[model samples]
Target: MNTLNLADGYKVDHRNQYPEGTELVYSNWTPRKSRIPGVDKVTFFGLQYFIKKYLQEDFDRNFFNKPKQEVVAEYRRRINAYLGPDAITFEHVEALHDLGYLPVEIKALPEGTRVPLRTAMFTIKNTLPQFFWVTNFLETILSCVIWMPCTSATISLEYRKILNQYAIETGGDMEFVPFQGHDFSFRGMAGLEAAMMSGAGHLLNFTGTDTIPAIDFLEEYYNADATKEMIGASVPATEHSVMCMGTELDEIETFKRLINETYPTGIVSIVSDTWDFWKVITEYVPQLKEQILVRDGKVVIRPDSGDPIKIICGDPEAEVGTPEYKGAVECLYETFGGTISETGYKLLDQHIGLIYGDSITLERCQQICENLKQKGFASTNVVFGIGSFTYQYVTRDTFGFAMKATYGEVNGQGREIFKDPKTDDGTKKSARGLLGIYKDANGNLEMKDRADYETEAGGELKTVYKDGQLLVEMSLAEIRDLQAQEVAMDLTQEESI
Candidate 1:
């Protein structure tokens, strides 16, 4: 497919729709509102990835690097067939191919910054007057590629906050927080690309992920090295099929083999609910207690079904003195006694732990942590497999994300453009004219729209890409450090409050 065809059908005709002598189209990408409660800000991420992958690599490979005539002919054939013969001229396509580079400038906030709702995260405009249509022409791809990573990163940050709060309150090791919220979302995502994007978003906040290609993506685009740093990691773990292969009757022997023979000196996870989950917890675990204790590593019990809160933290509605009532954490505690933390929370025995990955949510994660704390256990006693339910079940509207032209120039006269629909709520309302982003005295980001070009060029919204070249690139470590600073500031504010 021609890279130029990677847009809505209507976009091909948009070049001629602009007013006569229109020489510039300045647009900004903003999140108008947040549907997720307590997440008033969206994490700014993935712009460098988009610029590198699509604007530079894809265009060079699929469009610019090819013979000008070949690429132009391909674009013409596609457009004519899609929109009927000669719906639009191929002059712009030829012009772009002849230029051999994207003539646009993009300015953005630092990638890891948390941008408040209604504030623009980035702005784009054509650097060449004759190529003004290029800015919004790229809008379709920009919005499509950007929103998911931002949404996933924002949601992942919320999970980080929740887990961090619980870890502090429950006397858990702070170093273990990154490994607590593991990503199990790869298979559930929209496709391979979507999984990689959202999984990398998850990796921005956590180190444990089952999405293997997400690590590859970071190494490729974000300057991360798995050998030199902990980009993302996972332990040897079993699913239902691996357990079912041993048969439900021989499940105990399977656990014993995995612990003693398969993974003897490191963390191993086994799904415990292929048959009767409670029986495995109450009967099978105790029977193999000595084997587990004498082993040199942790055996993580994974319960994949039932109410996650109840499965890991006990059910108030179940019968007393049963495994269902005691829950996986308490049952493991009974089989292998553990110590209490300095803050008086129970730390599970080193040999055994628990993880629940099925349909987990932020509210459920909080409830599980709270229930465990109430039961006198550390929040770190169990890990969470954050799957597609959290990352896949979202859309661009998850944060009301949009890219709209706010300013334009026609006949050398600048126009302040905006839209506020009288027929509906203000989520569709857009910022007017050129925009500037600045930090307040308290270090919170604030927006100033309708500004002049000089003002828009100032503030924290620095130039990241210009004229087909990346101006500023952030490494994975730098992004993580920025996020940590933001999280620390947020926690400090919360403490003061």
Candidate 2:
């Protein structure tokens, strides 16, 4: 791992080897439109993390020089393994080794700002015209870094808006909204990096997370110190395996021990659907009510399987009087009767709550909030564990993210280039010419094409990366502030509508 070879890192054919007179290829990536309508703005994030993690290290010449021959041999060996011994024709990657650094410049919107669809978050191009191929060569890494974090940020913002609306209508404390949508996706993401990156995005709006690497990621790249700042955190929680160790016959004892002996002074979550979810709610909870009520902490009940909406907020159509009829909230209400607030919202007893972590979608979140309101319950009575279903089940095309070279220079001439494939409809048509992002009359981020960077005084994009150095760094607090501004704007607009 000490010697780095990128021969198979990208599509071998995409090495930018040939395209007549195409000494440079310029491209721009935009989320043409959201797959989910009304998702018009996306949160710009993860650029700092990606640049610090992937681009600023092990990639350039100085680092590669230490193991120069080994790096060259690996590249040659891998390429030859794929294309045959003599098909290797690119000077054994020595050109890159001798060059000693990447020749690239990157500009981007500050992390945490809201960008309108089709606006570029960041643009990359080769600083040395001869290394123009490096622009697209970096795409393999850029796409992986950009799309997922942005997508996760966008999704978390949408959740924030939903929770904010519910907080307003249900008289729940808005200050507590950030911790409502917790991250439980560490075990479910594509990899550790994926979890860390997406989890960082989640922390932009909330401080609750189970992804531990995210805290480390924020500390490393975003100037966040857990000892000094309230970074992502979570409480002790149990899974089926931990509960099943004592057997289902002793399940009630497990709950008693969790409340009385373990984690008695802070929030602790216990998954309650191991053998029988309804029995735990109707039978087991009553047995532990004294311990739960006097523990001076919260006990959050987790329902791992079942339709989340019906499980959290009861099915109005189900048989009304049977033990099988009541849901978690209703059952909890029966055991410890709660008082309604002035806004007519049911405030669950301080010691008990509900959480549903499985198969939660945006629509499910909306429905759950609305259903709880209809039942005179505050939306804050429950917390949501947004799992990989929200973070992992996405792709670049989820928002039509595509990076294409729009302008390049060659032979002392600058050319504006774009792709308008007529073979299909217009989803693939890209922007033409050099681009600039500026705020318009309404202070919304907008894109301008065929623009000069030096004279564009109104442009908001700034140089963040040049050559091998990261020129601009962002802290998590700065990102959170940007997101808060955008959320305030969105809420204002929503009220007018």
Candidate 3:
């Protein structure tokens, strides 16, 4: 059930077989931009777990456990088939593995910090005297480990910002903002690791997730044991399969059973749109009002299809009674007759609520919240299910993330390496020499190039990975605290603006 089981299987076999005499390949990776104008920072996360799980455990268990001769023979067989004959040597790999540890060091900005664009988040250095190619050799695995969690964390943080803004404006309970944007991306992720990593990223901002693997990942890697602290949770909710099992004609009966028979207490969600969504909301809901009202829990009606903004906030121009009828949130408000909050926004009745789970984007989320605010309704009446479109629909290039060697040593000499392609614009230019990150006086992130790692003093960048051992550890609670601090900083900046 480990997320790295498959990737660890074959990743040790992937290595470049050229450019002999390479004694070192030092690299530093950064998010140059977020592919959005005026967006200049990313939440740094999950690198330590990557290093521990894949670099240490996976390689040690799969590749290092093999006999040296057998490992060398396999590498030769595989590499020679691709490159002529004797393109490279596996002696260094065997030697390092035989030494029982990875001769590499990774210095990184503390996980959960809001790292600035074009600033180096991590610097990779090969500590082995002769194995200069080791650091670059691990680029395949390192890049794979770095990008997704950071991207997902950044995206989830953006969602948190939007929800927090609306909560502040509409007088919704600020504490509820953490659960306002739930993670519904498990079934939509690329694979198990993608689901767990991205889901863990979502947990950086919220406490609501349906991704089971994420909880395990947090407990295994981030010190978030469910028995100790609140990592993430979700209410008992029905999918289309469960609703369809009762057949469309008996859909109302299915709802009745879900409320009365299966879960009569706490919170429960039923996919109301399995047959006729509006009919369930406008007709059957009122008919079952007695049962729903008397129950000790809230019934969250889910609308899975149609334009989310219009479906949740009501269509201004569309005719009533049509399939594109007035949305679920507005309908719930009409039937329940809610009280107004101190901010003059309508708060739905405690017994009923709404959640939209289909094709939700950050832009659409803003529109839905704004529409509700304009209609005198608090954003708390509804929750948004952030899925793959917000998590998996991204790549390393989404933030221009790349790991390039900037400093290296060869033949008793120290070299500062860099690349600035003449064929392209300045976006490809990379940093030179050793790098370090520090927080400025105003609590903003700043970067600096150092003569060497030893010369750096009291910087925010810490030694996270060294000699196949993890040096720093973070917990889910600590990460949430950092995010809360970032939110406070953002609020302060907005006030200044």
Query: Which stretches in model 2 have alpha-carbon errors above 4 Å?
Result: 1-24, 60-63, 323-326, 453-458
Clashes per candidate (backbone, < 3 Å) = 0, 6, 2
* Highest-lDDT candidate: 1
Clashing pairs in 3: 23-132, 24-132
> Candidate 3 lDDT (Cα, whole model)?
0.82
Ranking by lDDT: 1, 3, 2
Over 40-98, each residue of candidate 2 has an lDDT whose tens digit, in order, gives 88888888887877776647433455566777666668767877886645652566667
Residue 242 CA error for candidate 2 (Å)? Answer: 2.3
TM-score: model 3 vs. ground truth: 0.93
lDDT of 3 by residue, 228-330 (tens): 7888989999999999899998888988888999998989998888878889988999888888888898999999998899899888788865435556777
Off by over 4 Å in 1: none
Give the Å shift of residue 242 in candidate 1.
1.8
Give a tens-digit lDDT track for model 1, residues 71-107.
8888888878888998889888889888989999999
Overlapping backbone residue pairs in candidate 2 total 6
> Where does candidate 3 stray beyond 4 Å?
1-24, 320-325, 450-458
